[model samples]
Target: MSKDTIKCKYIFEEDYNPLYVNGAQGGINSLGEIIINFYLERNALPKSQTFSVENGKISKENIDKVEPKDLKNSFVRVFQNGVVMNYQTAKEVHKWLGKHIESLEQIIDEQKDKK
Candidate 1:
């Protein structure tokens, strides 16, 4: 499939300093299953990862320090019901870093708003 099939969106605001936000939703067709992936990027590279939704909650760790080889291994594990996405290329893996950070920022913002 072409990379163009992936959809991404971003938003930015300027209040004293620039604040940026973005999110993406995509999927890969594998073994008759369409795995839908979600991501958010604020001001940096997006994280390449996926979450397992169970009972309306994410069922995976917010992974960090993931190497390309580790990603490949993870994907293999996931394919066999053992692990998760195996990121092969730097480009593919880097895509998720920003989203992870953005997600964290969003959580912090929500907490602040609640307080």
Candidate 2:
């Protein structure tokens, strides 16, 4: 058995921004496409803040105390962007991610054994 492959030159994008995402959340849209929204999980912002201003000699102070109040939320997920793909593409991505995850786990195990 033999296999044939094609080699092509790849071009790099001049302007690109790399973002760090911790989690993903999404579902199938109306068009029956898989939608995966990547997001960065972080602490929720405070509702409001209070600042204390005191008249010392000229200004209030070197560092004025600003207290954030009414912070009741635990965490928040800020969704940056999402990717939409068909069923076939979804399966391809699933296989690709599984392979990469397995490789990463093996690398981690190797590091642990070295230590």
Candidate 3:
């Protein structure tokens, strides 16, 4: 892993299957997607925004028309690293993090300091 890219690996139960969930899921899905998505949605600024590309250019009009949807219907595939989190799982993680944020933040800070 390079300094600019932080890679974390998590092993969840197969039940956390991304299939029957979202599409193109996995990798840093937890600390990056799942947790971030949870808060973004809660704040009414969900991360469902998407963009379209044509002729090597992003279509601004398409981005503006993006919308949110149920995660299950969001995609079709298996997560490679972290698993997809349903609303229940997301809420549980959010609550747990609320109680352990300081510790989590400290770990992140430690990683950053490693340079």
Best candidate, TM-score: 2
- Expressed as tens digits, the lDDT of each residue in 30-91 for candidate 3 is 44544222111112333566778899997774434556545334543333343466667777
Question: What lDDT is obtained when candidate 1 is compared to the true structure?
Answer: 0.49
Q: For residues 1-115, could you state the per-residue lDDT of candidate 1 as single tens digits?
A: 6565766786555544532324334444464333434343333333465566899998875455333425533322111111124435434656778788899999999999999
TM-score of 1: 0.23
Q: Please give each candidate's TM-score.
A: 0.23, 0.72, 0.22
Clashes of each: 16, 0, 1
2 against 3, candidate with superior TM-score: 2
List runs of model 2 lying over 4 Å from the truth: 1-5, 11-13, 53-69, 72-74
Q: What stretches of model 1 exceed 4 Å from their correct place? A: 1-88
Which candidate number has the best lDDT? 2
lDDT at 54, model 3: 94
lDDT of every predicted structure (CA atoms): 0.49, 0.80, 0.55
TM-score of 3: 0.22
